[model samples]
Structure formats: C-alpha cells, structure tokens
Target: MTLLTYLVPVVALLAQVAALPATSSAIHPRAPLAGQFAGDIGACPPLPMRTTVPTSVKDLRPDDFKAVMAIGDSITAAFAAEGMKLNPVENILENRGISFTMGGDKGAVTVANMLKRFSPKIVGASTGDRIVSLCSGRLCGIGGYFPQDRFNAALSGAKVENLDRELNYLIKTVKEDKTINYQKDWKFMSILIGANDMCDVCDGTNLDGDTYERLIRAAFEKVRINLPNTVINVMTIFKVSEIWPLTKNELQCKIKRALGLKALCGCAFVDGDTASGVAKRKVMDDYAAIWNQRLLKVVTEYRGKYDNFAVILDPAGGNTPLTQFDPSFVSNIDCFHPSERAHKYMARNLWNNLFLDSTNKAQKWPKDLDNTIYCPTATDRIQVA
Candidate 1:
C-alpha cells in the first residue's frame, strides 16, 4: 500500500480516538521537574528592579516580556508528546500544556514556565489538553481555545502556506485580550515552521527553495507590520532526513509503517539503504539546507530595520543529528515528534539562547541536558541585536 493510502486510515483512526472519553489509560505522564536539572533551582532571585523598562525591542530584558506566542505545526501543538509510552490511540491528543515553546502547565520544564520565573504575569502560554479535532483555522478560538491553546495558534499538519492564517489569528487574539497593552507590551514570539514543507518535498508538493522563501518572507512581513514591540525567535528547521535510519528498526515504528500510519514525514522514512533510498535521503537533506538558508535570509533582512521589532535566528535543531540523542528523546507512539524529555532539553537550550548573542548560540544539543538552564543576571538582556 502507498504511504498516502495508509494516511487515510490513520486520519480516520485519529478522529475516532479524539472522540473517546478520557480514561486512566489516557492520562498523560507528568513532565520532569525543572529543578531536577540542578540543585533546588527555584525562580531566579528577583533581579534588581529595572530603573525604567526599556521601550525598544533590542534593549528589553527577559523579565520585560509581557506575553508569549508561538506558530508552527504539530511540534508546537505538542501532538503525542506526553503519552510517549502510552497506548497509541491515547497518544493522539495534543499535549499543549507541556510543549517546549508555549506550554504553561506547572512543573513542566517549558519555555513559558522558565519565563514565568522571570515575568510571572506574562500571558498567552497554553495550558491543559486541547482536542486535536478542534485544532483548525481561526474557528478554533480568537486566540486558540483559551487555557488549552492561549496564543499558540499552531495547527497540526500545517505548512509554510498556512502561516498567514496562524499569524492573523495570533494578532486578533492578542488585541482582544484586555490585560495586554497591544502597542506597548514587550512580546516574545517563537516560530519553528517549514518542517512540514520539507516533509512533503518527495510527495510532489512543489515547495522548492524560491517558493519556500517567498511564503516565509511574506509571513515575517505580516509580523513586522502588525506586531510591534515584538521579538521573534525564528528557529531553523530540523534535518528530519537524518531520523529515518535511526528509527527504522524500532518495533512500534516498524508496525506503524507496515500499517501505512507513519505519514508524518514519509520522505524521511524511506526503507532500506539501497541506491534509491540513498538518493531520496540526499534530496531531503539538500531541500532542508535550502529551506533553512532561505529562513536565515528572511531573518537577516529584518535585522535593525525597526526599533521595536527584532527577529533572531535560533539554530537549535538545524545542525544537530538525531544520533546525538538517546532513542527515548523521540515519541514511542509513532517514533516521531519529540518526547517530553526532548521538550525539557529544548526549554533549557532556548532559555540559554535568549541570553547569548545570536552569533555565539550553541548549534548542537548540549552534552549535559541537566544543569543547562542559564540563570540571567542583573545585566542580561534578551539578545536580538
């Protein structure tokens, strides 16, 4: 059976699973404590109060951010992230509460939680379980189903083309929230898109380098025009082609493939080390490089162009090989999507990246996942310049 044909049943199964009532079997696993990474690391001792909050995006400190927002695909929605070792059906739910970028569930080591240590009043981090079926266009909520989605407008199965819709939703939602000062509050927005586009390269999606660049640049332009006092972290797309050989041997991954249910990135999961497979892998790698290059170019063009707007390129997953992590870093459900462990590691890396200039940010996964969270001092500002 073709991979596309297998995806048909998988979609139907996901819908059925979404309707099933919650049970003990469906309970998500608890995320690791943020403090476990180091000894009794509580919230940062309050930094000496700022003399006056900075008005420009380039000068704002981490604590100055008043809101957190995100846009991407399943990874940001955190599909199947919490129930990695649980029943496959149960793993289909969106675990937004612990997503690396915008999740706000207590005890979960997420960027939102990490930021809360600094700016306790910041709004927009997603919380609780979000029904995967309800995740769609602006119909989901003004700013996504509140508490469950908050300002995280990301949708599962989204591509670069869908970013405009997500950005519109985010803009409307933030404007609607009464607590936020839309024109004045410092906002931190994280974006990790293009993975879905890269996944469809071999699927005849026709998303070549130029097309990718145009679509992504258009999305950033919208952000620059609409969202003032915003600092955007434009993360580079992952080298997903490298994941196939590392995961092909896993039993659950094997069964999912046999049933044609492993459709997240069909281009990356091609079988065997034969000439055809090697050729396809190389093509995916080339496309990934092109996509990331275009993304960097888009960010570079936005630099220093506006005083209240800054876009920083975060090279977290861009260069890291899948082999750098243990097998547990990926979900056991479909052997795709990052597990909660991976999210914790990502939270730390992202937090540390905020303190350093873009040029000095670590390009590889930290050798020590534990104790990697960087504590900001009196002098640290969220780096965008």
Candidate 2:
C-alpha cells in the first residue's frame, strides 16, 4: 500500500503497453502525399530486387582509374575542408579515395545543377585526376546528394511535381554541354537522392507512401537513357529513426492515440507516443532517421538495375555506437560538419563495396577512445573570431 508498491504497478503497466504490436497501412490519409506511395502498406508489393541493401564487394584500387565528379547540396558541399572528416576517404574504398568537387550548394540542391557541375569533372581526363572513380573503363563518379536532387531543378522548395523537370534538365544538360562528351567519357554513376522529398512532405492532408517508389523508378529510367554505358551504384538509406525517432512528431502523436483507441489496444505505449521525456540528443538522432529512408530508396533501385552497378548500405554503419568522432583522429568538426575522421570512414565504405583491394586497416586511424589522454576539455568547444 506504500509508494513503492503503487509505482511498481504503474511501471509494469507502461512496460506492457509499450510491448503491444501495431498494424496499419504505412501511410494514412492524414499523412504526406507521395504521388506513388499511396497504396495499402500491407498490400503494396515488396520493393524491386534492385533495392537490396549493399554488401561487401571488391575494393576499388588507385588503378581502377578514370575521371570523376561529386554533386548535391550542403551535405555534399560539406565534403570540402574539415567536412571531409565526416567520412574518411580510406574508410570508403581502402586507398585514400581521390575526390574533388564538381559543384554543390549549402542550402537547397537539385539534379539539374548537379549534372551541370558533374559534366566538367568527368571529361577532365587524367589518371589520378579521376577523383573518386570506383569502376574503370571511362570516367566514373559518385554523388551522395541530398534527396531534393530527385525533384526540383531549382533546389529551392522541392516537391514531387518537379521530378520530371529535374530529370529532363540532366538529360538536356548532357546533350548540350559540348565541353564534356557525355557518351564518350562517362562510365559509372552513383546516386544517393530523395530524402528531402519525404521530409518535406511527410505530414499533412496526403498520406500515401506508394508514390515514393514510382518517382524513384522514373528517375532511374532517366539515368538509363541519359548515361547508357555508365555503371550506376545505388546505396540504400540507413536507419534514421535511431538518429531521428518517429514518435517525436506532433502528427505521429495523433496517429498513435487514434490507433490505441481504434484497435482496442494501447498504441501510445508501444509507439512511444506517451514518453514525455525524450532527450535532446535522442531527438536529433531521430531527425536523422526521418531523412535517411528517402534517399535510400533511390540507391537501392540503381543497384538492382545493372550488374556492373553496385549497392552499398549504411555508409556509416550504426553498430559502431559512436556519433561524432574526435576531429583530430576520426573526425574534423566544422561546426556540425564532419571532421576528417568521418570523411575517411565514408571513403573506406565506398571503396569496400565497389573496388577490389585490401582493407586499409593499418592506417594511422584514431581509436574510438574518449580517454582523458586524448580527449579535450571545455576549452575545445569554445571559439573566438
């Protein structure tokens, strides 16, 4: 009858509520409208074979050699300077992957401008000049672009309606740019786009998830036509829910409460809608998840279409249990931008999946240690201009 006894019962009830199962269509009418994603989540067909997650593949060597280019938005632009540390080149393919920018913006981004920037790099022909070319034959490049690339050409405020325009612009750019011989020089292409489309449209009056699949398919088709000989690598999106949890959204709360009542079950507990105190750190992680899945679909489809093309999953494997690594060793922090360590990780992951080479496990890579010996104190976070 004491406080301890009363609290025990309450805690037990909450735990039981959390464990309940959930059943519903992936997208509801109140959710965002994905032109093609509007089918019954249960009845919708499994994603095409091309969408399979990437597994270990050959290491790309320095000799796999050819021209290359990179394209996308702020996330892609962040690759320069300290941003490179976010995902290291060594972690990508083994040898320090040679990479240089084609073009990118910090805010909004789209595929049209990406094609324009990327064209110059591929035709710049030289052996080491080939940037991060994974496959060899002609020029090859990888674009870990933000999802907005799939839709709007302007990259300002993207939407599903803009997808066709973006694709056509890429095609037209390749056809018109005389300096770069798209047919003669281009050999391989890697695409990582579409996260923003979902992030922007996830809530509101239209709640269909079917359109996501359709738009992706159409984009791939455009790639097939525009770059015929190129081997395309597609990477599936990693789990962002770990970084950006779903239950945190106001819209999600309504769904949880409704489901709990409609199904005669405690959906709030199971869906985590009632957890009043989610940490700030946890919320940031969940936000990352929301954006992750959007681009992953694009990567999967590209890989599934062609044999020479490859698929990579979780470029930053979540199992590592570390978010931001030390800038000096594994990371280079430019504000929120990745440190050198992080870039190295990205480079190695790319190398492992496409290139055939020994793992660069013996490099001067930093340990996952946060020991006081190497760890910085309060002084590190301070800045003076």
Candidate 3:
C-alpha cells in the first residue's frame, strides 16, 4: 500500500509535466534571483541595487564599457597553449562572433579568463590590451554563454598587493590608447583575490583579518580615486575549505601531482580529509570566511560612498551554504582555479547583478521560463518580449 501510494503521486507528476505545452517561449514568471549565476539570463533576476555600475540595460550599445578589466592571480592570467603559439580559446571566441581580441601572450584557458565569459552580447573591449603580460599558464571554459565579455587583466601569483601594482599598468594602457575620456566613460572592473593569503601558508606571511581587510579596502579606495566613473564589482573570495573537500580525494589531484603540476593556488596541497590537512583547511576556511565578511562590510560602506560599487556575496563563502558547486567547476589541471564554465557562472552572477533591475523593468520572455526550466527543450524555442 505504501509503495503504491508513493508511486501514484510520482506518476501523476510525470504525466503532468509531459502534458504541458511544448514551448520555450511560454515560461511562467517567478520572482527574480538576487543577482546569481544559476539560471538563464532570460530568467531575469533582481538587480544588485540602484547604485550599480552599468549605465542601463537598454543602453544596448554593441560596446559598453570604455574598458572591461580583470585582476587577480592565475585565475585571471592568460597563458599560451603552446607558450608562443596562437590560443585556440581566443580564436574560438572570435569565430563565434564575440567581439574580443587577445593583446598580450595567449592564455591557457582563454574562455574563462576575461570579459568574454558571460557578458552581454552587446559588450565591447576598450583600447585595453587582451592578455595581461604577467600571466604565463593555461588556466581554465564556456557553453550556454552569451557573447560580449570582460577582458583579462589578471596576472598569475597575484596577491592583493600585486593587484595594487597592476592597477597602474591597466589604467595607463587604457588611457594611452585614447579610446575614451577617463573621467566620463565607464570602465568595468572585477576583483577576485586573497586565496594565496589563506591557502598558500607556505609563504609564512599569515596576515591577521585586520591587515588583510585593510589591503583590500585600500585597493578599492584607490581604484575609485584613480578611475573615475569606474564600476567596481567585488566577488567575495572563494572558500578554500569547499575546494579541499572536492578535489582532495579525487583522482584528478593525484594525476596533477604525478605529472609534476601545481594548482594555480595550490589548493590540492591542503587536504582536509587527513588530520593535519584538516587543521590547515579549517584555518584557511576561517580566513576565507573572515575575508568574505570583511568584503561585504566594506562593500556596504563603499556602495554608500561611491555610488558605483557593488558586492556579490559568493554563495560559496560561508558554511554549508546554498550555492553548492561541483568539482567540475574547478580546472582538472590543477583543480584550484575555476574552470571555463565556472567563469561563465561568474560572469552570469555579475551580469545578473548589474542588469537584473533594468531587466525587471523590461518585458518577460518565455512566458514560463522559470517554471519550465526543467521541461523538455524540443517543444519550446520561442522568445517572448
């Protein structure tokens, strides 16, 4: 009797879904997400805030920012596949009609590094360089992606201070190009750093929460003063603890070590399953939490003061969090830096936060988008405006 009762409801649910009309354009609307990367952009999420950085979604110019810049460690660096040859990743994006071009040496994972990941189809690159000369490795992917992405200004082994160093390089080049007036035109910036401070304890420079937050705060403040009208989006540094559990036991980590490879951030070295590794992992996770908390607090302050800054609280930041990503999100080579698709997710969140508000003001599409997200695709492909 119990099995039959359970089966009855399950069978009915399947039948109902099967009976639904086949139409991608007929999605039922739901409340917008809080600027996340989980769903299709067509499923409009809420905006970050009124004080966000983009001009307006309706400002659908093919090229949006005066310059779209990224900064960080290996996560942001561009490496050549052949260490001097043409990067297939860059070529693929260009071939897809995405308006992006590499300037510096090629990147290992071109799709994940720069502005091209999940940006609006109308996005553009400034006279800014494509790859930051500092990076030197394959880093990480993209599918179900929209064109018009951000550019890679990130360098390898970049700590918070390294970004402080690279700021001048990025700004000077863009300004020298004379593509847009620095004071008037908007520049897009993505800041994701601090992993080394937490995980790479090998450096032995264990900064307290105060010192770490100070460096981060100083970086943001400097950007505001240096780049007028710049839109700064800060992603909460990813949780190192989450990473340890994912790859520590997986065969990929072992293979990476066997091949004499190192993760961009060395996350594999901190195995939480073991006793000693767990201790270190706990401390690093603590550091990550403290940094994320400080980031949000600082962002709240900056948002009020600058009127062009916003913070995207990473779902991966805190304990037992809601935004759970699988190991595939990280690269297989080193398993530390995000995979290409992960970059797409990152871009999706940033894009959602930047444009969701404007999208809300626009028309709904696929009348039942959120509702039928799990529905079969063959039946629906219409775009409702």
- Return whichever of 2 and 3 wins on lDDT: 3
**Candidate 2 lDDT trough over 10 residues, lowest sum:** 376-385
For model 1, how does the per-residue alpha-carbon lDDT over 285-340 read when each residue is reduced to its tens digit? Answer: 88888888888888888888888899999886788787766667777656777888
List lDDT for all candidates, in order: 0.72, 0.30, 0.43
Residue 263 shift from truth in candidate 2, angstroms: 35
- lDDT per residue, candidate 3, 286-343, as tens digits? 7777777787677667533444433323332233331255666565534555554444
Q: Please report, as a residue range, the 10-residue window in candidate 1 with the lowest summed lDDT.
A: 18-27
- Rank all candidate structures by their lDDT, best first, as comma-separated numbers: 1, 3, 2
Q: Model 1: residues >4 Å from true position, as ranges?
A: 1-43, 84-89, 133-147
Model 1 gets an lDDT of 0.72
- Cα lDDT tens digits for candidate 2, 82-163: 3222233321211111121222222111121122222323332111111222211121112222332221122212233344
Residue pairs in collision within model 1: none
For all the candidates, what are their Cα RMSDs to the real structure?
A: 7.3, 21.1, 14.7
